[model samples]
Target: MKQNITDLSVLELSNLIKSKSISCTEVTDSFLRHIDDLNPQINAFCDIFHESAVRDAKLADAAIAQGHYSSPLHGIPIGLKDLTPTSGSTTTFGSKLFKTNMPEHDAILVERLRKKGAIIVGKTNTPEFGHKGVTDNLIFGKTRNPWNLTKVAGGSSGGSAAAVAARMVPIAEGSDGAGSIRIPAALCGVVGFKPSFGRIPDVAGPFSSTTPFFHNGPISRNVHDSFIFYRAMAGEDHRDPFSIPTNSSQPTKPLPPLNRLKIAYSRKLDYFQVSADVENCLDATIARLSNLGYQVEEVDLGLGLDVEECFMTLWRFKLSSTYGGLKKNELHLLEPTVQQLISEGNKITPAKYGRAIKVRERVWDIISRLFSNYDFLVCPTTSVPAFDIDKESPRRINGIEINSLIGWFLTYPFNLTGNPAISLPVGFCTSGLPVGMQVIGQRLDDTRLLQFSETIELENQWRS
Candidate 1:
C-alpha cells in the first residue's frame, strides 16, 4: 500500500523534502486538504491559513533549491494552539472576548519554527483561557476525539492532539499549565512531551513569566518528531528571564542504555482513583518493561491529598491575577469555569496563597527525593480514557466523583515540580479508546527522557 503523505511522520517528510523527492508545496497542500476534509467534523482547527501556508511552502522549496537546508522541520506543516499568538493572525485564546484579537509579533516558539522552515497551516482550538481539561469554548465549540467523535479530544491542547492523531498535521505545538499537553495526548493517543520548565522559552507576558507549573511543548504521533520540535524551540531569550541558558544545538553526549535504568511506578499515585481498564493497560506495560530487561518496581509516592488542593489554589490564583479585573465588566463573556475560577481566586487571602506555595515546595521535595533514587518514574497518564465530549470531564473515575477540572489527570504533579514528562500510547481500552503511560524524568534532563521514550517507542511499536 502506498503511504499517504499526510500519514508520514515529521522526520519522514523532512527526509523526502531534503532529498527533493517531494516539494514543500506538495506536502503543505496534502495536509491543508486533509484539514479541509476533517476539521469541520472534529472542530480541531479554529483558524486555517490556506494562502499563507502555500506561500511559505513555496519559499521553503525555493530555499532548498538554493541548497540551504535549515533544520529537520524545513518545509513541514504544523499547527499552533489557538492560545499562541501569531503575528497578523487571529489568536482568540478560545474566548469570544478575544475573538478579533491579533498580535503584532509571533511568539518566541513561533518565530523559531518559522525560521526553521515550518509552515503554520492554522490555529488549533483550545478551551477559554485554556482553563480546563477538556477543549470547548463559546467561540469555537468543542473538539472531538478522532478515535471516537462521541468522546472528548482532551485539552486545553485538544485541537493539537486531534490534528496529529487524525493525520491532518504531523506535528503541533501545545502548552501545559496543568496537563494541557499530556492530558490530550493521552486521550488522543499521540505523543505529547512537556520538557522541564524553562527549557522552551515561554515569553507570554506577565502570566507566563511568573508561573512555575506552566510549560510549552510539542504534540506528535511519535517520540522522534516531538524531539525535533523540542530541539527547535529550546534556547535562552533575554525577554524570558526563566528561559534556560543553554544552547539549543543537538546534543552529542549519549544517554545511558534503558536496560540499566531504574524505574519506579505508581498505579494511582497513592491517592487518585484509576479505572480498571487504564490500570490493566498500565500493568501490561510494566510487564513489557520487565521483559525488556528494565528494572521496574512499584512504589508508594507519599503525595498527600493536600497536593491536589494546593495545585488548584495556585491555578485559580494565576487565573484571577490575569483576568480578575474583567470580572466586574466582562464576566458574561468568559466561560463559566473561568468566571468561577476568577471569583474563587479573588477570595483567597495572601496568607492562604502563601501557604499553598509552601505545600508546593513540600511536594517538590518528595518528587526530588524520588528522582535521587530512580532514573525514571512511570504511571498511567490519565485515570480514564476519552469520555463524553459534552461534559468537561468524567463525573467519576472508578465511581469516585471528580470535583476538579484537572483531577482525573496524573500529569500535573510533574508540571508543579518542573520535571520533564512524555505520554506514550500503551494500548487501548475495551471501549476502543487509547490508553497512555507517562514517563517522567528528572528536571532539566530532557535529552535522557527523549532517548528513553524513543527506546520504548521502538520496543512497543504501539502504532503498529
Candidate 2:
C-alpha cells in the first residue's frame, strides 16, 4: 500500500528513498508543491529555495543510486529557523538590522544537517533575535497558525512549527532559549523536543554563545521522526563553549513497560491561574495515565514566584549584551520592543544579575529532589491556549489578572536548570486550539524522555 507523500513520516520517506520505492526528486516536488500551496497563507518561510531544493534532490537520487546515502536525513527537505545561518542564505533573525546579513558558512547545526544529506529548503520565520514568546517580527511580518489562521503559531520557532504542522516540511530546526520550540509545538499540535542545553551545539548562536540556557532542537509532527532528526544534529562540537562531551554515541532506545514507571505531574509549580481548557485537558490526561498504571502523583517543585524574576534577569542580560554590540548608527533599525527590552537589560547591574543567579541556584537545588524519586515530571506546556496574533499572552488565566505574557509560560524554569524537556500534543481546547503536555527529564536523559514520549504518542494517537 502506498502512503500519501505528504503524509509520510521523515523516517518513512528516508526508507522509501533508500529502497528505490521513491526518488528524492519526487519527495522534494511533493513538499515544494505543498509549500507553494500553503506558505502564502501560512507565511511559514522567510525564504524559499525551490530551485536549489530540486537540484539537491536530483543529487540525492544519484548518491543513493551509487550507495552513498549519508544518513536518515539524506535528501530530506528541512527548514532552518531564521535564527540559524546557512552559507548562502540570508538569515534575518526576524529583525531589520540583519535583514541583509549572510554568513560565510552554515551554522554548526546547519553543517551537521548538510553532512547528513539533508536538503536545506529555506529559512523559516522567527521573532527578532527570537526574544519573545510570540512569532511576529519587524522584518518578515508574522507567521499565521495553520490550524487557525487568525491565531498565533507560538514562537520564536513559530515558523518551523507551522511549516511542520502544515506538511510543507516533515521536520525543521528550532532553538529554545525559553520554550521557543515547545510553545509552538503545543499550539501547532506537533512534537517539540529541547534536548539538554548542550546536547545540540549553538557554535554560531546569534546571541551570546556563553549562555547555557539557550538550546537547539528539532520540531516534527511525531516523536519518532524527531528522534531520527535530532540524532543527526546532536553531538560534541568544541566550538560551542557549552556543548556536551558525554558519549551519547547511539540512537534513542525503546522504553521498558510502563507499569513500574513513575511520572510526577504538576499543574502549576506554585499557584498560577490556569485556563479551564488547559485544566480540563490535563485532568483527562492525568486520568488516562492513572489508568495506564503509571504512578502519577501531584507535586510542586516550589520554584517560587521569584524564579520568574531570576529567569527574566538572565534573559534580559543576554539580550542586552547581544544588542550592545550593534553599531550605534544601526541601532535605529531594531524593533522598538527589542530596543525597550534591551534597555531594561542594560539597566541590570552585575550585582542584580548575581542575585538572580542565587535564586536560580535555589530552584536547581530544590527541583533536583523531584528526580530522586520520579523518572519524569509532566506539566502543561502553557498556562493558556494560543491567544490573539497581535497581542501578547492572554490578559488573564482563569480570570486571574496576568501581568506579563511570559507569566503564562512554564518552560523557562527548565531552561534555567539545563534540563531536558519535550512538549507533546495531549489534546485540544474547546475552541480547537491544541494543548500540549510537557514531559521533562533529568539532565542528560534525553533518550529516555524521547522513548517515554513515543510511548504516550502511540497511546494517544496525536497528529495534526
- The TM-scores of all predictions, comma-separated, are 0.97, 0.96
Please give the CA lDDT of all the candidate structures.
Answer: 0.90, 0.86
lDDT of 2 by residue, 79-105 (tens): 999988787878888888888998888
Error of 2 at 350 (Å): 2.0
Candidate 2 steric clashes: 0
What is the C-alpha lDDT profile of model 1 across 1-464, one tens digit per residue? 18999989999999999999999999999999999999999999999999999999999999999999999999999999999989989999998889999899999999999999999999999999888889999988999999999999999999999999999999999999888999999999999999988888884773454444788899999999999999999888887878885554666346657677899989988888899999999999899989988989899988977888888888888888888888455788998888999999989999988888898898789889998899889999999999987665676777788765877999887767989999999899999899999999988888888998988888889878
Clashing pairs in 1: none
lDDT of 2 at 40: 90
Worst 10 residues of 2 by lDDT: 203-212
Name the runs in model 1 displaced over 4 angstroms. Answer: 206-209, 248-254
